[model samples]
Target: MKRTWIKKSLLVILLVGILFVLAGTVYLKMNTYAPSEAALAVAKTGKSEDQILFFEGEQGKPAIIFYQGALVEKESYSLWAQEVAKAGYPVYLVATPLNLPVLQQNAAEAIIAEHQLTAVVMGGHSLGGVMSSRFVSSHLDHAIKGVFFLASYPDEKGSLENFSGSVLSITGDRDGVLNQEAYQEAQRFLPDQTVYEVIAGGNHAGFGSYGEQKGDQSATITNEEQQTQISQLLIRWLENLE
Candidate 1:
């Protein structure tokens, strides 16, 4: 009877593992947003290959490296990067492994090194933002000047409470995926000069090109409107870093 029970337990574990794999596959397929013409167009402004969208600006100028949110295609945040690049600095929309930023924590390092970006700022949307904060904190010796978050905040695991550089935190008022308690608490971890902006009537998915995200409130603004607002905000903040 003991042997029989052991076999049954193993079988149950196998079934559960298979179920989890299937769920993950489905989730990834459903969430990966395709790059649009506008996004490609922006990429063409510099280079579009190797899963890295580059909007080239003045050489040696500071660059902004962006991380992709969980299960989100890297191109989803191209709109913001494009706008920043137009403002002067090259913007890199880093493609993380398995579309998860946490899995590729040091991905930004390679981009910054290979591109010869002297001064850099890191940013992202949602989980991307959280991971970017973690990267900057761990690599404090690197020349990263600051961090930006869209519809996201750093948790204790990636807290920036003692970070000395500039930080920008932008969120949509209607963001349902963002934890209200955590975001409010994150203020304590950021520097006093952190720039926080709340986009009126915006939602979590508004920061990316992906379709409506599950558990997120519907946005009162169109995707273009929301993205444009974020773009302008990023432009102003990054330019100030000059």
Candidate 2:
């Protein structure tokens, strides 16, 4: 009788431990993430990143290629990508090199050669926009249908003579990182073909990662709101493009 009682007690303890672990796992997953979720998730290392050829958009339209901000990983752009994709165009988010050596430019060169990119639209946030400009300027081809500048600084390092393509420049009314006056002045010199969109109360870091981009911890808005606003504006602007 003593041995029987001990065995029953141990079994109850073991079952309780298993139930606790299962409950903890479920709670974690509820707060954390799942693979199929559209939010950004990191790509594993050691796997060959795929080529930049065209990704299929809705209704057979051309795709938009998204370039990520400096130090902002590709996973961080996944939410933005899905929003754009929902607007009838699929999105390809490219990884910029650590050195930032016009890496996407090289990727574009290879991608353009292999893919039948019908109407390419390039857009990026902050430094990523600068890199996109570099890629478009060097390519010198009409394959790029248009360009979107998201809280970005124009290419001051190079002459803006070659950026004659359609431009959609977006900056928040309260953006501190990008010089609005400088961007406006630069737009004036660009052959009179640029459009600017300003979001009220939106700031500079609102353009990128929620935590990583907000070093000062002084950001005034949530990432979900910013992503929704920016993505919606981009889609509406792209739709207006001829």
lDDT of 1 by residue, 109-153 (tens): 888788777799899888899899888888888988889999888
Alpha-carbon lDDT of model 2: 0.63
List candidate 2 segments past 4 Å from native: 1-38, 41-56, 99-104, 156-164, 212-217
**What TM-score does each of the candidates earn?**
0.86, 0.70
- Model 2, poorest ten-residue lDDT window? 40-49
lDDT of each structure?
0.83, 0.63
RMSD of 2: 13.7
Residue pairs in collision within model 1: 161-189
